[model samples]
Target: MTDEASAFVPGHVTGFFSVERTDDPTTTGSRGGGLALTDGVRVTVRPAEETTVVLDDVGVEIGAVDRVLDALGAQATVIGETDLPIGAGFGVSGAMALGTALAGNAVFDRRLLRDELVTIAHGAEVQAGTGLGDVVAQAAGGITLRLEPGGPMENRLDAIPARSRVEYVTFGELDTATVISGDTDRLTLAGEEALSTVVAEPTVSEFMYAARKFAREANLLTAEVRDVITDVSAANGEASMAMLGETVFALGDGLSSAGYEPQVCQVDPAGATLVDDRDVDGEITGRSADGSE
Candidate 1:
């Protein structure tokens, strides 16, 4: 095993989702559609006397990350960096947990498969209540459409099969657990409708249209978010709110055309991957996190 290892996990934004909760965390997940952005988390791992997690230069105790270490039976200093706003529907927690799983597995010589690492991280997020669908979507990458819920073992995933530049602007944060904890009757119904609509013609425009409809029917949009969407539509752009966050995302140059300077990135087709590894000898030329060429 190397003294240090690094992994990169793309950030995921769920446009709309339907939740399914069971007693088992492994089986609990969400059915949704979202984009995996190139703007994501980069995690570095090194052997430490004790386990710790730091993000963006600040020490933090992320529950899902801790749980991943426990599941892997490994301890290390995990450092993560990302520009995506936390609690703003960018799936930062899931990215951290999943990144740790990948980097930790490598650093500790866990010898576990990448799918196993993904399940470990996905389960940790479900147990911590920090996320539902983010881990799986981030793991799969691209414009993701989660057809079935649960971890990699029990879930079915599809994508929009197209690519484009993604644009996003965030207004503020939303409490994900609070919103998802109560009465998903409305959310589930709206999400199912949106999922079906997108499934019929899995296109970027269709995804945006369904997500906008879900945001309206689910009644989760803040005034600022709604206004931005209205402005973007008025400018003849397809835009939608990121589910569970007061963030708006548009495809292509939608936000730019609408006079909003949004953070721009391309869709990440290659999900999570090992960036590099290090030992006393120098860099260890590594393969993908999944152990593929």
Candidate 2:
């Protein structure tokens, strides 16, 4: 078996989404539009006596990651790193699951096809209630339009085929399960309107406009994010709130030009991919430390 393997999965931020739920986990996901960021997660899998999961050096019990490992039927040490904050609309949980699946497949010689691996990770996310379309979006990259709601194999997706400099700042996190499990009729309706508007135009500027409208219509934007968006817009930059979190994302150098020191990254065109692995002769030097996800 390979000594270890690594994979990089992009962080995703949903601009607007319509919830779609079903009995089958594989068929359950969200119909949404979002951007995959270059500032994302990188995961490495190595053989270990027992299963262990760490994100940013912190050991966290991620149910989705556990489900992915269980599906692969392998116990290994997984180390994930990302500057993006989890539960703040950055798709950290989904990224970790997808990254682990990609790396563990090679580390354990599972040989699961990429599609199958994505489905596994997507299913895990859905079942765990950690995410819906993020795994799929992170897999596709760029500005993704989730045309249909399902796992990777069961879903339909398209991208804007464009890229831009992305900047973001998070005020805090939101409980996704609390929001998605509640009455989504209003949210869904507003989301559909926003999605339609973007689908018609399908440009970065339009996307930001539609997202801003969706946030207002759906009543999902926090005051802090709202102020941030206003600031960026006043600076003549496109900005909007990220769905399911108190995050403000802007195109180009909106945040910087607005005098906000937000994290900066670009739209990741490649999405998730496997990085080079370490050989048995050496070891992966990502030391385990205490931290949060």
Candidate 3:
């Protein structure tokens, strides 16, 4: 029997954070206190004789799937595909880990609860040093405020209502591990302030403003990225540099008019989902989350 499933996760922009590690074995990775974005990652998994992972857009090491397989004590070929640029602060790794865990459980009939599946994915990413909060934000979807960080169940999340279109452009990748492991005293301090300001207002514009401030104060902005931000701001558009990446995400046509081919996306209201595929005759039947054709 061959089974397949897919999940869609939105990209997130973390404004600020205070990292905390817990001794709880049930949780994995340090707690990430940040914000979730609408433009993010999408992953699909299928059963195979041997475990294998393939990424469509960017080239990076694939270990999250292996971690999931180890935890489940099962073997299957997993394929993860995403349009978002990997290692570009789009939370590709976190989304892939979460998608693999959820889809693998379904394929194997593991009967794990939703929260359990999320934890498995979270643990994999955390242990791998790929991400800290992307899984939590992806699971919640939309504009999310991660008040407390840990695994899914161990974290506290609240959504900030936003229906605005998001535009983004990627120039290059940044190593998440290198940045996360570095001295983040300034980053953490700026992030704490940004989080407080946004939580008090909780609007899309305010979020973008806070993110921009965090990027600057954290000393994460590159020269090229700064130029993009300046151009976007000059055009009177709200834009912010994505954390740990050489990318800039703007809210409107400000960047586009400045000769940037921005990829436009919307806030994903639904998180990851399972897709049921059945082979009928010579055709395959696929079902969406709502059981629609």
Candidate 4:
């Protein structure tokens, strides 16, 4: 189940890359399902100029690609390029896996369901060492309580109520892998107790508390990181750091006051989508180095 690349920036909970499995059910507002979804920020990292790589777009074709093909016996073109900025704590590998699964599902006549696609996509991410909890958030969208990792799309996905939303603010750039690898404990925090309570707690209240706690941590929220959060928060936007310490995200009611301020609005409850549909005004085609278009 290859996936489209995505970013898993920091500012949330941390534990390195520990995967836990449990029998709890993740749902929201009486709506429920047996599926596990991930959350994170995702961006397309295109090169400043046209470029090419020498692999099978590893991000797009993880171990599950063969499984997907075997299940449907589908033959589709798997195209991937380093269009995403790596080492910046983005879930580039996760995005590739998810994107591949999404694309493969389309090409394979929809042999696998959406939940199945998510499972395959996540499997690929676990294999890669470049993710935090963003995969679960991005897969689930909105605000979520990622209880445990692995298998069958079983997670607690809660929609951000009308009064709740997120704001993503990035300041400067840092290598996500390096940040995590350097201190090992600098980015770690205790979200388990909080997450456990959040699962059955009121969505608004839980998020409000989490948002407050997230703002107070020092190791997770370094000085430089805090400054960005403070600037945005002072502007009436709630803020946090993205995984890898490179970017910061702020949550708020609305970003109208943040106009042209070089920050992205961070409230996506429906998850992320990649469309084959192109912008006629901005069509892009990736080619190999051999002058092949």
Candidate 1: clashing pairs of residues: none
Backbone collisions counted per model: 0, 0, 6, 50
Model 1 misses residue 201 by how many Å? 1.0
In TM-score terms, candidate 2 sits at: 0.93
TM-score of each: 0.94, 0.93, 0.87, 0.58
- What's the true lDDT of residue 104 in model 4? 57
Candidate 4 stretches greater than 4 Å from native = 1-90, 154-156, 162-166, 172-189, 196-218, 253-260, 272-293
By summed lDDT, the worst window of 10 consecutive residues in model 2 runs over 284-293
Q: State how far residue 12 of model 4 sits from its true place (Å).
A: 11
Off by over 4 Å in 3: 24-41, 57-60, 277-293
Per-residue CA lDDT of model 2 for 231-258, tens digit only, reads 9989999999887788999988999999
Per-residue lDDT of model 3, residues 1-293, tens digit only: 34576655556655555555556524544333333444455566666777777777434456766898778777766666555677788787877788788777877778899889888888887777777777877777777777766887777777777655667898999888888777867776787787778889998888888888888888888999999999888888988887768988877565787779987765566666564434334422121222223
Q: Which residue ranges in model 1 land beyond 4 Å of their true spot?
A: 277-293
Note the residue pairs that clash in candidate 2: none
Pairs of residues at least 3 apart in sequence or in different chains that clash in candidate 3: 10-40, 11-39, 11-40, 12-37, 16-191, 48-77
Q: What is the lDDT of residue 254 in candidate 1?
A: 89
Models ranked on lDDT = 1, 2, 3, 4
